[model samples]
Target chain A: MQDVPELVAQAREGRPRAVARLISLVEGASPQLREVMAALAPLAGNAYVIGVTGSPGVGKSTSTSALVSAYRKAGKRVAVLAVDPSSPFSGGALLGDRVRMSEHASDPGVYIRSMATRGHLGGLAWAAPQAIRVLDAAGCDVILVETVGVGQSEVEIASQADTSVVLLAPGMGDGIQAAKAGILEIGDVYVVNKADRDGADATARELNHMLGLGESRGPGDWRPPIIKTVAARGEGIDEVVEALEKHRAWLEEHDALTRRRARRAAHEVETIAVTTLRERIGDLHGDRRLGALAERIVAGELDPYTAADELVAGLTDGA
Target chain B: MQDVPELVAQAREGRPRAVARLISLVEGASPQLREVMAALAPLAGNAYVIGVTGSPGVGKSTSTSALVSAYRKAGKRVAVLAVDPSSPFSGGALLGDRVRMSEHASDPGVYIRSMATRGHLGGLAWAAPQAIRVLDAAGCDVILVETVGVGQSEVEIASQADTSVVLLAPGMGDGIQAAKAGILEIGDVYVVNKADRDGADATARELNHMLGLGESRGPGDWRPPIIKTVAARGEGIDEVVEALEKHRAWLEEHDALTRRRARRAAHEVETIAVTTLRERIGDLHGDRRLGALAERIVAGELDPYTAADELVAGLTDGA
Candidate 1:
């Protein structure tokens, strides 16, 4: 219930509970969450945020787990916000992203949490950043956002990161399914995970071919190196991390970090606007005047614009 | 540029060139186009728009072609607007949807045209409906709006249709993907395309289970039957037509059709507003003040909200 500023202050003071609470409140969209988020906004610019996204079985979770483990091994603090869309039958979901990095749960060096996409609005409107804020306050030097790989729309996750890593599996059928897909363009680093598998090299070669074909989405000599990773065996985790570091270097030089944050902030505002406007319309359901008008409109007795004006008029007069 | 009233009139008078030109002109942030669309607004409700969407390789084209042919066989004139996403480099695409219905194309009873989903916000937002309007006035009883398959961000097509058919392919590992996807919940009819493939029965049974588990989205008793179809063989097209007719009857009896059209009207208006706003920004691109602001925003020198507000203010202040 505390204001976001005070909560953010506590989080910056190294309070894990405070950071977690901020994240939970934002996810829940608690009434006062916005004011709190605004207060904490200024404290969020320090951490390196990397987003990992790919198809469902492309080893996103495994790659994330390996990278987090590597960062923790370097004695650096890290956090992971693994996003998954929840099931209709069960409201709760198991965030198995930490399946490979289980030791971190017992070790103090790493923190991982799973969040839901919640509903049809597939993009990360605010959940990812709010989680990032918590990670930043938790003193994590690096935070990784791993998308559930539903494709296309989930590209929002990568756009939010300082450096984006797009994951691909070998022999995933010529990678033709992804050839013209704009999702691959969001990558700052491409990882051919399950590299130990047959045709993994083929996937990598195809990715390099793709990188050569397009107008670069980013500046610099950042070719979005394809780091082949046997994530299950930790075979190429170091190389993946190296590619990530190279991206981080580019961000530092251009100072694109702030602009990235600014872009996300704008998107957050737009999404909130759209969702809020629609939500407000629901509150006008009961008035008979609007009801009759809706009925009449449905009965083809009146035009939609005229009907809408009449419906809103009742709300306005009532207000 | 004689204006929307005259253009809509000419389109109604069977001017194909006028209809195409109007749709192109109206589909952007151009003030003139918005003015024209507003003038032509009251004429949109006469079309029975059927939107068909599903994942790639689901045989959507084949199914659409069959339905159009079926309508033709029933002696009802039909118009098909198959939207295809273009290869970013080619700008040209084969709307091969006609391949399945090539049988009827020369009959003078069917009109099938493939429309491109112009990238970065073009056809989907504007041109589509204009094409629909032309078809509506051309004496077509059924206008099929075959949306370009945009996975995840697909609700746009549903919002625009009187009836929406969600086609799913069998053997797709993600039955759960479609179920929780909000797509299952939106469809007025569900078709299991490629039913000859292995595990088709299981996919249908699972879809039935999921459908049974949820509350219906509207006032329709039609359970969106899982019609099996090997569209390539022209199989089950009759069942698809039957399902569509059942939905039409449900809409007519329960008066959901008017409400559906109203909502579609609202969406069309919003699309127009957004498209017009974007075009306005595009037109003023050469203005030095806006250019500097855009450079600063993209370069991470300033937040987009601040930049956007300044641009809006500058435009109004007659700067």
Candidate 2:
């Protein structure tokens, strides 16, 4: 198992089995993942992460596939983590997201991993980033994290991405409601996927209206060029890629890239820091006195607030 | 502010103004909240947390109000944390669920506090629990944490409750879908709220199927009871309370309550541990070495994993 570093090296050399095993090891939270990452981290930064997110059934996966195909044709390797919280026991998506995304399974340039729900809330908070780190280390030119269905975390995709594309389909509902999901604020490039569906133009119009409300954000510095695409048929992908490049250029032009990178670094550290804290808390449950004190508080012999304070500082109370 | 301990004592003496002010201090993460909690912790465990959650607009608030009414009539003081994630700028809900819960406002026995979602992920991650602790310390016999819409952190409700009642509307797409949302496994008592709507039986049946197909794994002395309710007419409030009591008793018979309490104490302490670690990490963010290391990592001359390790250990190889 110490050869995990060698395996990571082989995985980076594009060995299919090695790559699969490496991802499995990382996804399983193998302590060895740290060793692999330690060896592989210097090889990363070649990949740019693009987060595609929207409501369920919004064609995010299809749009992602189309984008993957486009990127592959442009001679770039891509990796995708279609994140979902499905039934862990059945290993089945109660939603058809994972099945639909398996379309690119046969592609040589594309690596798609469907992550299951892990032990905690907040979308397997560490898995997606760790997976992206692996892909980045493995020499993918681009990595795409397609998030779980729309909500608070959905809007977070923008913060995670160097280029974030909020995927939308016209037929689901009103675009204003979608905008109110507040996903519109995060979009560097707007993608109206499933453009052939009816009411696409109206959604686009409404989206523009919502975006119009942000004039105080300083004069449309980033117009969030909306690209219409029928992702199932692979249309409008070039323009999407072109728009991404334009955004990337804009990021560099305005020094936003430096700021964005700094923000990403801060976020990455915060996630790791918070997760470490959670793990430490898990370890402290073994203290018998603390446990008994807690029971007493719950039973009303002592108070919870005072108990919590004492419990925290008890180890060094005399110090 | 430093007189928070005095305020807490006043709250324990049943002063409503003191209770509100104490909870405000707690929910807003004021430094005084710690002092208040230090005085109030022993007072907390008397209140049983009853968590009610389901899809948005599935009449959760209505169900909660009815339950509060039932509990109040039973001579129990009730507090409801109607958790609503607010718009960051205005601190208002996307929709005012409190308006729907207006019927309970005039009742002195029932204290309803509508919490605005703060910087903390719509109050679920941090603020709501702080508010709940205040309510619990203030001697509310039962605390109902009505969810602020389901998502990543919202699922934390399962851990927060002594008895979780997962509320569902009839034909809420499919009962199996709720199971995927981790709802089936969370509830000790599942309420098919709005059973007056057709397909309530179908939903119950599906949930039962899910439970039997390997979700429920308690001592197995008592099944996770499913109660049917049409909360609007207060038709099933008594039954829901009955089910809650039954589950509570079952836990005693099987001694699962001890295990459950242990879990809650561990979770609470774990959150504190994590918060402390993050504070420690935050203290290092402005260090000169960190700035240099971050620059190197961003410039592609250093890897983040090594950078993180060095940052944590305060190691520097730079001359």
lDDT of 1 by residue, A205-230 (tens): 77777778455655455566778888
Candidate 1 residue-wise lDDT at A194 = 86
TM-score of 1: 0.72
Best by TM-score: 2
TM-score of each: 0.72, 0.77
Each candidate's fnat: 0.04, 0.32
Error of 2 at A161 (Å): 3.3
- The alpha-carbon lDDT assigned to residue A121 of candidate 2 equals 29
Model 2: per-residue Cα lDDT over B70-118, one tens digit each = 8878899888776655311112212224455556556666676766556
Give each model's clash number: 4, 7
Q: Per-residue alpha-carbon lDDT of model 2 for A93-176, expressed as tens digits?
A: 122234555555566677766676676423456656667777787888888877744556545644578888887889667476
TM (chain A) per model: 0.84, 0.85
Best by lDDT: 2
